[model samples]
Target: MLSLFPQILFLAPLALTLLRVVLAIYLAYIAWYLLSRHAEIEHAELPIIGHARHGILWLSAISISAIAALLFIGAWTQVVAIFATVISLKQLVFYKRLKEILPFPPSTCILLLCISLTLIVSGAGGFAFDLPL
Candidate 1:
C-alpha cells in the first residue's frame, strides 16, 4: 500500500476533477430545485461590492480560461495549481458574499464549489506536462 501511494498521489488530481464534475451536476440539479420551489434563486439578487454578481462570474470565467491556456501551453502544473487554488479561494469569497446578499440554493453553492475545485485540479496537468508535447 505504501508503494502505491506515489501512484495515487500522481493520479489524484485527475480523479478529483472527475468527481468535481459529478458534484457540479448534482448542484446544478439543486439550482433547478430552487427555481422550481420559487426560492430566492428565482428573484433578482442583491449587488456585491456595489456591483452585480455578473462581475464575479466573469472573473471566474477568465480564471478558468487562463488555467486552460496554461494547460494548453504545457506550463508548470504545480505553479499553475497554486494560482488556481488562490483563485478558488477568491471564488469562495464570492460565494460567501453572494450567499449573504442573495441566499443562493444549496445546489448552486455545490456547483460553485465544484467548479473551483475542478479548476484547481485541472490546472495541475500531469505534474506540469510530462510528455513535452
Candidate 2:
C-alpha cells in the first residue's frame, strides 16, 4: 500500500479539502440539530461542555465551521489543520452518540484527524490554494 502513495498524491489536495468541508458540515449540522431540536434533552454527560451554558455549543459549532472553511481552501494549512485536529478530537470525546457517526471502527473524527495530519505533513498538494510548505 505504501507504493500507492505517490500514485494518488495528485488527489491529496482535493481529498483533504473535501474531508475538511464534510467534517465542518457534519459538526455544524449536529450542533444545529441538537441545539434547535433537542435543546431541553439535557446531555449532561458531555465531559467538556456539560457544565457550560448551551451557548458554548453554538460557539463551538460556528468555530468549527469557520475552521473547516479555512481548511477547505488550504489557508494556513498547517495551523488550521492542527486546530481542526484538536477540535475534532475534543468533539469526539464530548459528543454523545458515537454509534450514530459510524457503525464500524475508525470513527469520523479519527479519519478526519488522520487526513488533517497528512495535510500538515505533506502540505496541501498540487491543487491547493495555498501551496504545501
Q: State which candidate has the highest lDDT.
A: 2
Instruction: Work out how many backbone clashes candidate 2 has.
Output: 0
Per-residue error at 119 for model 2, in Å? 1.2
Give a tens-digit lDDT track for model 2, residues 63-112: 76677666656577777788867865765664564434322234766776
Q: For model 1, what is the alpha-carbon lDDT of residue 128?
A: 38
> What's the distance in Å from true for residue 130, model 2?
1.8
List of clashing residue pairs for candidate 2: none
Could you tell me every candidate's TM-score relative to the true structure?
0.37, 0.63
Determine the C-alpha RMSD for candidate 2 after optimal superposition of all C-alphas.
Answer: 4.5
Q: What lDDT tens digits, residue by residue, belong to model 1 across residues 9-84?
A: 7776566445444433443443343344343333435344543354444554455565545544445543554554
Once fitted onto the true fold, the runs of candidate 1 whose alpha carbons sit more than 4 angstroms away are 1-49, 52-60, 72-74, 100-133
Global CA lDDT computed for model 1: 0.47
